[model samples]
Target: MTGGVPEGPGDDRWGSDGGWDDGSLDATARVVDADSSEEERRIEAALRPRRLTDFPGQQRVRDQLGLVLEAARRRQAPPDHVLLSGPPGLGKTTLAMIIAAELEQPIRITSGPAIQHAGDLAAVLSSMSEGEVLFLDEIHRMSRPAEEMLYLAMEDFRVDVIVGKGPGATAIPLELPPFTVVGATTRSGLLPAPLRDRFGFTGHLDFYSTEDLVKILTRNATLLEIEADPAGVEQIASRSRGTPRIANRLLRRVRDWAQVHGRHVVDLPAAEAALDLFDVDARGLDRLDRAVLEALCQRFGGGPVGLSTLAVAVGEEPDTVETVAEPFLVREGFMVRTPRGRAASPLAWQHLGLTPPQGSPGAGAGSQDTLPLSGDVGRFSG
Candidate 1:
């Protein structure tokens, strides 16, 4: 554990170790972050599954990836460029490393944000040895020029290095070693068709089921040498927001609680206490998430409020509201986005212990009698 960041089999490219920071109040146990301490990162890296077969969830992606890697192994060549698309914390980066491990190749890690210029990408690509795996995280956010350069590199294993000033610039073709490029992104739609099309396989990761999360937390407990009961593990898994990273994080917090309380084993009470201390509810809604839901239902009267309005009301960046809070909320059926704005669902009203006001956005067809849908008015379906 070098400076809290473990050097592991796939440390080459800074693939996503769930890529979240343990900063702010959310650090108590928030899983939807992009910054974290080196120690925490190392711990996460250490916990990652090095082999695809060892991976916990996303069975479809796991099996498909297995075939792709196996085929390449038989051919003794690098596998096709792979694109991993999913929300944060679903193990895109871990899968990238597993690809390199299965292929028995060195991997060079980098992110779209890191490669601001074409030169940045060219440098990394050109330095790669034969059959190296280039794991690029957040590949959708790469700069246009860098992305253009990557197109050629991914397709032909070559890059155009421009030398000299603008008018005198000479395009020298740089042939890179035949390498496999594995790209991970939270937003695949943002990628241009040309870039997306270059990928030979695209794997979309979805949320882990409670059973899968339980398996992940149980494995983590054994690895961390923490004594935890099945009830404790299940309780933690249920409130982990359907994320393995969150489940592991909650397990660590529960371990701390157990140690402090003089309990050798983590029990359901300890799990509940730890989660309560961290301000995560039974449904995995954090303070920030609750704040958004409350603001929408209570302040905006079930909302049709714009994202900026909602963000300002909740004291968070619009991006955070959109990216971090909204996706989960939307996925969990607590909120809906319409052409006009975001609105709370009836479930959101119920979760907050309030009845949906008659004629309100969430009040349903019964309220439609009083508040008919207007052609010009935005409607939220599903």
Candidate 2:
């Protein structure tokens, strides 16, 4: 919707209406990217739950956050600066919108990458009205100067505006109306301690349960006016990688497949067919996901290879692989990122129908079938 959005549906973002994209093939994005494309964002808006009560997952976060809002309302003031920390696509931005809606105030949207300087941040903070909500996505990525400026703005609701050159510069004191800053970040640990301390409430979102994802898919199916069988809906939900954004995004693609094939309703076969067309395997691992595993197990000899080396083996940039594919792989136990480098778990070997060599990391652990579907191999590093 702004400068970074693709003019059409074919930019860095993928899997929107009007075009069929094999999401994992893109250089810098995936179908399930946390940084989704504009068209996908448009579709997502229609599917988002407008209120906290209606939000489908993260029930604990919802309950705790509800109390914060209610208490703020009673005091007739904006709630404390709230920080929502989690992986992308876990509804941080959606929750930010819901907060403003519940408070009945206007909300301003921006990202950490967009604010380059202290002056830029000062301008945004200065333009606020009382009780308004400023939703900052990827708040951890803000520039050092902007981040320092944010510390004061969050605590004191004021900013020091500098005028003139280095030595001649003057700090102009400016008071701001009391407003709420709702910041979302995937990497909260990167935030400076002083800045992190300013947030009154910090909520960490986790993956949705299979039941939650199913409920989400079913609700959106009716909203999108798609007649889908329970089997089709369940199939899609199972392979959704436990993320709501992915569940809804896949629904559209399956719907498109149904329409083209002259099927009046989506069934299990239809779901499978659509996913196959998109190169999504039964476990929701796309081509890129499998590529990373293959490179680790086959090419790198179950490496301990560097991320850069693995990315090169797969013909992708390191960041693209790290951001777009590695998280899910690490989360789902297909790979591991040790200090040595990236390595395949035993599950990764079995998934590729190969045996882990003797003494390989996790090689003695047994077959991939013996592994849990969502094991914690280790945290994926940025």
Indicate which candidate wins on lDDT.
Answer: 1
Give lDDT: candidate 2, residue 104. 81
Question: Tens digit of lDDT per residue, candidate 1, span 77-139?
Answer: 888999999988888888988888888776666778877888888867766678878788889
- Per TM-score, the best of the predicted structures is 1
TM-score of each prediction = 0.87, 0.85
Q: Model 1 segments beyond 4 Å from truth?
A: 1-35, 364-382
In candidate 2 the C-alpha lDDT for residue 220 amounts to 94
Misplaced by over 4 Å in model 2 are 1-41, 357-382
* Pairs clashing within candidate 1: 4-38, 4-39, 12-109, 13-109, 19-34, 20-33, 20-34, 20-35, 21-35, 21-36
